[model samples]
Target: MSRPSVWAPKIVALIKGGNSSAAIAQIKVAPTVKDLQDLRKLLIAANLLKPHPNVDAATNDMIAELSAPRLHRSP
Candidate 1:
């Protein structure tokens, strides 16, 4: 896998290990449309993402993606 693709398993392990990095970061807890798309990737890869693959992951992931301090937007 490429560097970016590898991030998925790491987050999955975090979830499987019962860690809440997002909560610790005080994530937004409710993401916007852009963050939702990002989170869907993570959750789906982690296999905790859905009964409906088309559905959004928990608001936490969305929030985490949305409100995690400052960051770059994909180009």
Candidate 2:
């Protein structure tokens, strides 16, 4: 778990000390798009991003396309 104190130590301290409003005011419930993009970049940099492919479905689609008959035109 990430240390809650990293972003707002004073807010965390206030919460532990039972100050609700101040803690709530200091807390960020939502991250910005930039923050999400930065996190994605970080995960990619750490090689932790694993993308899985639907191999069977892809293969079946390819086979279907390949098996479809092609029409020829006379010159």
Candidate 3:
């Protein structure tokens, strides 16, 4: 599991810790085109980053636990 202080957990918390309609109706939660493009670019760059062998093993173990029914689905 990811540490509570980590970015992954923070992203999950931000997206899940709210009511959908209430959040959309009462708060400005839209991402602008530029904002989305920037995020996409960042994700692409991150995906292209080299994976260390040790990190890959650890990530594989974590993903196996998370996707028990489809271990090969993830990259």
Best by TM-score: 1
| lDDT (Cα, tens digit) per residue for candidate 2, span 3-43 | 32233334334544656455444333313333333433443
lDDT of 2: 0.39
- Give the poorly placed runs of model 2, Cα more than 4 Å off: 1-29, 51-75
TM-score of each: 0.33, 0.29, 0.26
User: What C-alpha lDDT values do all the predictions have?
Assistant: 0.47, 0.39, 0.34
Clash count per candidate:
1, 0, 0
State in Å the error of residue 60, model 3: 1.7
Q: Across residues 1-75, which tens digit of lDDT does each residue of candidate 3 receive? A: 843223333322333454333322222332233333333244345552133233223333444444446546656
Models, CA RMSD each: 8.2, 19.6, 15.8
Indicate whether candidate 1 or candidate 2 has the larger lDDT. Answer: 1
- State residue 12's C-alpha deviation in candidate 1, in Å: 0.8
Q: Which is better, 1 or 3, measured by lDDT?
A: 1
Give the C-alpha lDDT of model 3.
Answer: 0.34
Candidate 1 lDDT over residue span 2-73, tens digit each = 333443344455555656554223223332435445545666676664543323334445555555666666
Q: Mark the regions of model 3 whose C-alpha exceeds 4 Å error after superposition.
A: 1-6, 9-44, 47-51, 69-75
